[model samples]
Target: MKKILMSACFLGQKVRYDGQDSLLEHPLIQQWKEEGHIVPFCPEVAGGLPTPRHPAEITTRHPVMVVNLIGEDVTPQFLQGAELAVEKAKEVGACCALLKSRSPSCGNRETYNGNFDGTLVPGSGVTAAELQRHGIPVFNERELDQLVEFMTMQEADVA
Candidate 1:
């Protein structure tokens, strides 16, 4: 069975910056849980950020700066977490990653624009980018079905 690297918050774990879980109660996730193919992780927490952490975002793309709402730079921690996440994915032989959207560490397609003004832009988060760079495909929660399709193709190739 191919394992999946998942964002902890999607597993109903309170690992989000606000100490909340972005629970995704989907049947496919339930199936993966039953199959023991879920490797739950939170890059922000893994990088040494605390629960109820100051919400952060990518303030710059060139140097990839992650700054909290209070203007503190947390880029190093985010980078550390991203590295850890990639390692974990490799360790578990994860076929893909299902991450939280709009998160500084987990977003696969888009993250907060770092202005703290409720804007969004096209981009991948730190962890997501790392995972991708290592050849692990990343998916947001909204793309579960798409992930399933990709997984099917992977299995097909193996078979």
Candidate 2:
């Protein structure tokens, strides 16, 4: 079975910035759990940010930069977290990452627009982008159907 890297929150861990869990009820995730194919991780927390910490966002479209609501630049920490996540994926030989949606560290294709105004925009989070750069396909919880297709393709390639 292919190993999957996933957000810690999805696994019911209190790893979110707010120190709360975002447990997943999706069937695909449950299936993975039953099969023991999931590896849970949290980039932000792994990078040394505290629980109940300030939320951060990618503040630009180019030359990506992450910043907190208080106007503090957190790019280095985010990048470090992303790199660590990549290391975890490599260590486990993860075929993909199932990340939290709209998170600065885990969003796959859409994150907060950086205004602290609750607007969203198209862009993968630091860890998601880093994982993709390292050849791991990243998906949000909503993209389980698409992940099934990807897994099938991977299986075909292995065969």
Candidate 3:
């Protein structure tokens, strides 16, 4: 059986920066859970950052560039968390990740801007980038349908 990495918040965990949960209760996630494919995780929590911590954003020219906009430097902690996430994925035999978009730690393709102006931009979160680097396909919450399709195709191929 194949496994998938999931954002803890999306799974109803209160690990968001504001100490709240995203709680995206969707049929697709429920289906995946029934199929035993979820491996929930929160990279920020794994990195030792407490809930309700300062929300940081990428401040570099691109997502690939490592720079923090809220403070001096948090790149190392992010990287460490990313590594740990990847390790956990490996341990669980997960080949894909469903991340919380707009987060500095889990956003796959879009994240919040540090300007605090409620603006969004193209970017990959730290853990998302690391998972991509390791060949783990990462998707945002809205992309659950595509993920389900992809997983179905993979299952078909295997069978």
Error of 1 at 47 (Å): 0.4
Using TM-score as the yardstick, the better of models 1 and 2 is 1
| Model 3, residue pairs in steric clash | none
Off by over 4 Å in 2: none
Candidate 2 — worst ten consecutive residues by lDDT sum? 53-62
Instruction: Give the clash total for candidate 2.
Output: 0
- In terms of lDDT, which candidate is stronger, 1 or 2? 1
**All models: lDDT?**
0.92, 0.90, 0.83
Name the candidate that leads on TM-score. 1
In terms of lDDT, model 3 sits at 0.83
Better candidate by TM-score, 2 or 3? 2
Q: Write the per-residue lDDT of candidate 3 for residues 15-114, one digit (tens) a residue.
A: 9878999998888788878888899899988987778877677666344434444665676667788999999999999979999988888999887776
Q: Clashes per prediction? A: 0, 0, 0
Query: Could you tell which candidate, 2 or 3, scores higher by lDDT?
Result: 2
Off by over 4 Å in 3: 61-72
TM-score of each: 0.97, 0.93, 0.90
